[model samples]
Target: MAPACEPLPVQLGAPSTADPHARYARLREAGPVHPARLPDGTVCWLVTRYEEARKALAHPCLSTDPAHASPKYEHPPWEHGPPQALLAEAAGRHVLHSDPPAHDRLRNLVNRAFGTPRSAFWRRDVERIVDGALARLAGRDEPELLSGFALPVALAVISEVLGVPHALRARLEESAEALVTVGGRPATPNAARAAAGEVIRLMTGLFREKRAAPADDLLSDLASAADEEGGPLDEGDLIATACLLLFTGYETVAYALCNSVINLLVRPDQLAAARASPALLASAIDELLRFEGPGDSAALRYTTASVRLGDVDIPRGECVLVSIQSANRDRCRFAEPERLDISREPGDHLAFGHGIHHCVGAPLARLEIEVALHRLLTRFPALRLAVDATELEWHHLMPLRSARSLPVRL
Candidate 1:
């Protein structure tokens, strides 16, 4: 480690706080990995800068499992419950928390169900979902979008994909909001646990229903994701994997929508550029992903051994938070890094991460963003923020960024 700097503290910000893009600019200016501390005072390292970050993300030395994380940190690996485990631990042994052959195993099983969204059937469903939301917004006066539009669209698409029954969706939403939150972190541990538990009960029963009357959908395939001997995954494994897929897409996609739409609204010029060329919407979504992504850091990855990134050597077992927000805005890779250019192709932003841990739902997420934004903008050409940009409340999620609500008047 070069070892000449003030420690960068990552977890101090309010869950609703916004990133000080400048702080990252300085980190990139100096070096990549820096000695840092978690909110719990566990000595760790923070990696910014593009090249070093890409290396760190895909590096063999980094372990995604919380068991491999620095042991000094306070709280149990799954303290905030399974949804949190979905983010941190390889708990229930799902992919986001896994590595290598195990990661490949879990991912392949889930992939059988999450087939291409680009197919005519799925695209029509997505379009219908998006257009319905847009249509509802059209007649309202200064419609509030967080719950009304963004959240529902995200949930509906995933529900359709998951084959969650309509009857359970209300409970699912209540429990889902309890288990995980958008533009924010999950609820308190006890609350999240209860919510997560309810979700488990609901999904487990849903899976059983599917078993008796097998449906041609993702949840059915997952409920039946076989073990080495070809029997269905046990109850706990089934629920964990089931919730993993739903929880993974639920809030992140919604918050991502909030981020991109708010970005366009606040910058009229960029908004105009996007509106002028429908062809550029896809590129704009990529830029939005790079600019204000769903996460600040990739899930905590523990170093397996001392590894040198640039001049800094991250020690064994210390959790390394790879700053995707910082890396995506890196001037070394992105020209005019701070500027929001809808046309610029921000290549391979770590928005969905990289390598073995790349988001399995990347295509679904892109489909959501592209369809939601395109339809929203096209349907309401005069759509603009109803409130001043400064009044917009950001979610206080450290590492994850999103707006609490977006108020717009057509």
Candidate 2:
């Protein structure tokens, strides 16, 4: 069983300083669903235990639409001074924000882009990018692996998949990184909002161009997406989807890649096991993803009706945040859940998500992480953390990931 620790009571929205998984474990011990609030003072529930979270995530009574589920709900703004239309579109229309028929409509349109055969094509490019980046680091004394190697590989593959122009890719990537990573520095509401707006503006322009002159890119494909009836998604939905693809699409993979590399570096036994047997690489990636998945609570799922989750009757219209991290570590769900064991066989893991909203890109994500870890370990057999592992700074407060940079010597 995980150790017991209770979070000190604080204002509903205040960020916790303790490690995120530790916080989740503590919260899970308390109960499956606990009360919390968004930064903008909206009351919400945190669903922490494995079974409750799995059920809650797929429960029809729960909703992803904040507008309908919790109309009065307010969230900290991603950017200031943006037009309300842009903000509203961003807030309400994406595939992540819809439920049921609407969610299926939006998801179906974009799902083919990530189909198995399509992902295979992407994997080739991903490998090429990973190889090129590693080659660049061949003779360097020390290269910050996250920035120099991992981030570039993710950006290159995603950009190519999205059909971002070579000329505009750099700027687009910078703005997307700012929006996704929150400046790739310390995060604050204002900074995060500005980053979001900047990326939104760039995507808006790209969408406009693609609609006018269709190209052979993801944007072009989305630009022309239509059913025999009217289009399934509107202009706003397209923009939101595009932004979602670019912004969210790369961050998780990058974090997992960095985290996996760091884990191998620190745990020599596991590292040696992986290096000794190529067959172990795939298992190591899956375990790494489960042990330290980059994502946090599902963005928003409010109760439409009074719902009973683990004996707690959450009132109607209350927002619920399902902790993917917490569920993965629940002892009842896995034997010795706290410990990392690559030999463990596959089981139900919520690292990506569950039910109707399971991540569309799980296949691609696994491919990237597996390929990156295998190549990095093989190429840099002597790879070691340049600074002490304790000395490496972690961006713990962010909901998306814990580490900012993983500095290493080749």
**Best model number under TM-score:** 1
**TM-score of structure candidate 2:** 0.88
Candidate 2 lDDT over residue span 187-289, tens digit each: 3556556766776677778777887897766777777774325545677776777666665567777887888888778888888988888788886677887
Q: Candidate 1 residues 1-410, lDDT tens each?
A: 44334554544334544456777787777778776655445555778889998998899988776767666644432322237563222226556667766666667777756764433466788999998888787779889888889888988888888899888899899988776655455578677767767777787788878776767777777666653344444455556767777876777788899889999988989888888887888767888999998776787787788878888777787777788888998988988989988888658789889877888878888889998998888888888899998888786455567777788888
Backbone clashes, each candidate: 7, 2
lDDT of each: 0.75, 0.71
Best candidate according to lDDT: 1
Superposed by TM-score, candidate 1 places the C-alpha of residue 11 at a distance from the truth, in angstroms, of 5.4
- Candidates in order, TM-scores: namely 0.90, 0.88
**Runs of candidate 1 exceeding 4 Å displacement:** 1-11, 15-19, 73-82, 86-91, 116-120, 182-186, 227-235
Q: Which residue segments of model 2 deviate by more than 4 Å?
A: 1-18, 37-42, 69-92, 182-195, 212-216, 227-232
